[model samples]
Target chain A: MIEDKKTKILIVEDEMIINKMYAEELRSQGFLVLTATNGGEGLELALREKPDLILLDILMPIMDGLTMMSKLREKDLYGKNVPIILLTNLSASEEKIMSAITKNEPAYYLIKSDWDLSQIVEKIKERLSRKV
Target chain B: MRSQIQKKNFEEDLTNARIAAQNVLEDLDIEKTKVEKERAKEVAILLSIGDGLVVTDENGNIMLINKVAEKLLGRKKEEVMGKVFSDAILGIEDKEGKVISLEKRPMNLALTAGTATVNSIYYYVRKNKTRFPVAITVTPIVFEGKVIGAVEVFRDITHEREIDEEKSEFISLASHQLKTPPTAVKLLTERLLSGKMGTLTEKQKEYLNDIRFSNQRMIDLTNALLNVSRIELGAFTIQVQKKNACAIVQSVLDELEPITKGEQPKLKTIFPEQNIMLMLDEPLFRMIITNLVTNAIHYTASEGEIVVECKTINKGETVGGKLLKENYFVVVISDTGYGIPQVQQNKVFTKFFRADNAREKHVNGTGLGLYIAKSIMDHSGGLIWFMSRENKGSVFYAAIPMTGMRTKVGT
Candidate 1:
């Protein structure tokens, strides 16, 4: 644990400010951060990079977080087992998002406005620890 | 000879005057007819409207009914003519389906109160004994300071209600969508303030804190607006799952603890050894508890004592409307804050209604918290009320049914 290298974290968010800020925060926490603007790009990165954890967003321009996750799960066997936390502002009742959640993997829904960045970092760490 | 000529001229002048007076009378008749035509046109316009119109005399007898009214009540204008207003339209009730008393009826109220009663939602039974909701306005026909008659114009609101529900659904969805950008702003601000980017000077940190505070307010406002939209639009959904009641409260307290770090009020928590498992929608339960407790912390003075207690009440105990035989949970959050003004207590739960004292004390409250809480409670088989004294303290009690007694009924 003491000689641990940086944990690779993928933040799939549409908004630039949120993506940049989260990436920086995770970087500060000694996690190598990967960024994607939309779900399509996110799916590509997830397949290529195979990060330690993912922070997914629900809503996006071209293909959403859930769809990307579905595609990633199909393409990568370890994707389903990887810890993914939903970081978005959409309501929990959104049908498409809910369906995406069910079809893919178990993920935590974190409302962006509800939790601070530090709290989100804590959640990411907690989920990673759980996987171990 | 000159006097005879002058007398003859005077007689001619009188004849001309008589002819002029007859012409003036003819013009008056024409004017009267024009005025009568305009009145008829006004009546026709009223009758042509889609809304049902019923005019009653001071004695409450039906004087007139429009085509729409006749169709709505399933009664002909002739059949209901001279009939008592209440008798002809017999099954008049409040929104709750209880018979409206004579005095409480809009027409009667307009007559007695000498004011127009508008936008009252009431149910009217048709001749076929089927009841439908109607939005009505009753205006007293006043003549010489006397209540001569009353005209009630109403519309069958079933279609309108449907449209309203549809609009509410849109707003709920739109509000949820609208929150995404603000959430991004909030996250970035939080990250910046926590020195994620780099070490900052004190002044720079202060500016970031200001931005963070402003961002947090936006977050709270948007959340409140979203909740209100969901409630008002009848788009609220509750999913009941088994969870520990105490854990829910603890999470809410934890969320608020960061804000209350400085000059934190003393929170006394009383939790059971074995946490009672509650069948509740975690979000809704959290909302209710969080609102009450947050209000307590916000309103209370620094270092004031706030007690957050939870216990079980057995069945047959008269709580809110329901007599519960099953185990019910009661969460009491009391605080030594500026208690609600006694005069404004009744309106505490009303939407967008802030008491004078509260408005004077806190500038940030949207006055929608208690309203959203009450609505959640009403739908979730829970009841929320409070006992408060001016300048003393307030104790808010929320009783939730543990058996998931939810109603599909919504306003």
Candidate 2:
């Protein structure tokens, strides 16, 4: 069926409902999806799977997304080059968020409440297309 | 016989002179006692002042300091008296924790400029190496048209600051928590409406759409409340950069185009041939423009028109009795909509103030957009005002100084 050939995406979110909903939507869109409830688990899965793209949430238990992203970026060439999009409820004007975005090159962020699920899917697709 | 008469006259003259000298000495003693009483009273008044008070001489030397000042500075009166004002009370820092330069110290400014300076965003370090936020006022002491020294009064605002920080923290946390449910609902509703799970009837779809709309409104209210809290706390950071004014306005218009589509109001724009480069916080500038335009659209009828014009003016005009002077990059948003009633015009920028007409026309407004916008403008060294008649439309004007927005490093 060549199901294994589909592009893989990893979602690291602490909220179970949101993670499940996103996973369902992306799976229906014909992408292989992996989910992690926290940053530590997300980082381990990301390193092992080497997914095409990572969707990260900033505020999480057992290590935050930025910490994990930085650690992953430090791991190897594959980690440094992978596309990571930060999805959070934090305002972009926040000092911490702004600084983190500037430091993490080639990273994009979307305020979850401000963006619709469809728009987020569209953004994911746009990022994947650009990577290709 | 003549010698005896001369002796008697000489003795009488001597007695009168002696009496006059004794009376003069008594008067001098009484005057000295009164002066001492007045001086003691002045000293008592200075020592009893609630706020920390320090008086300096023309050369910025500390002349007198009250008991409160001594306790706050963690130094004895004998130790700091006659020392340089700024040096005696060392380690003054700005809100960013940067040490204040000598030239920028309020006492120095008051002494040099001969003006009163009041500031609340400063921290003072005590002798024990402990620091606390302070609200300080320094006034130049002038006598007979000559600039003397300065009088500084300060209070430790640690308690007030703690309360404010707690309030802001609570609001931020509450707003985030409040938004999460709405976000989940919005996403789930969108997923259900996509019809990937099952085929839905028209009525079901319509009901889901209503749910989504209401959920979106809840999210908007949360955001607005958060912004208001930030404004009240003076915690919003402003990073100023030079950007094209026209381009910023165009971008806002583009973002609002989706809402404008299929709406009754016809949106139009007028831009100068040459784009004006203004120093502004781009996001904040965009927010101001968006708020005004959105309000215009919401208030105006479908058959009405909305116009957004951008231009540069060498001199500013007074609108609604507020004078906006100097060179400015101005944006004027005018709409043919239900205007605000004249009786309620003054309260347009107040929090939670919706005019009777506005509440009647638009039901979902949180009445915070203009208040937040006005606070931002005031912080940015910009101006926002409008004129409206009950029956006619309203015109809102926002002016940004050519010099640029005031950059603030805030939480």
Best by DockQ: 2
TM-score of 1: 0.66
Clashes of 1: 3
Off-target runs (Cα >4 Å) in candidate 2 are A1-4, B1-32, B87-89, B127-130, B229-236, B261-266, B300-305, B315-326, B335-361, B386-394, B406-411
| Candidate 1 chain B, run of 10 with poorest lDDT | B402-411
Instruction: List the global CA lDDT of all models.
Output: 0.81, 0.89
CAPRI-wise, candidate 2 is medium
Off by more than 4 A, model 1: A1-8, A75-82, A129-132, B1-159, B162-181, B258-265, B269-275, B314-328, B405-411
Per model, kept true contacts as a fraction are 0.75, 0.75
B223-314: candidate 1 lDDT, tens digit per residue: 88888877776656677778888788878888888766788678888876448887888888888888898888778888688998888888
Write one digit per residue (lDDT tens) for candidate 1, span A19-124: 8888888887788899999998888888789888999987788988877777777775777677788887776655566667777666768778788878888888
Error of 2 at A14 (Å): 2.5
Best by TM-score: 2
Question: Cα miss at A84, model 1 (Å)?
Answer: 3.0
lDDT for B338 in candidate 1 is 90
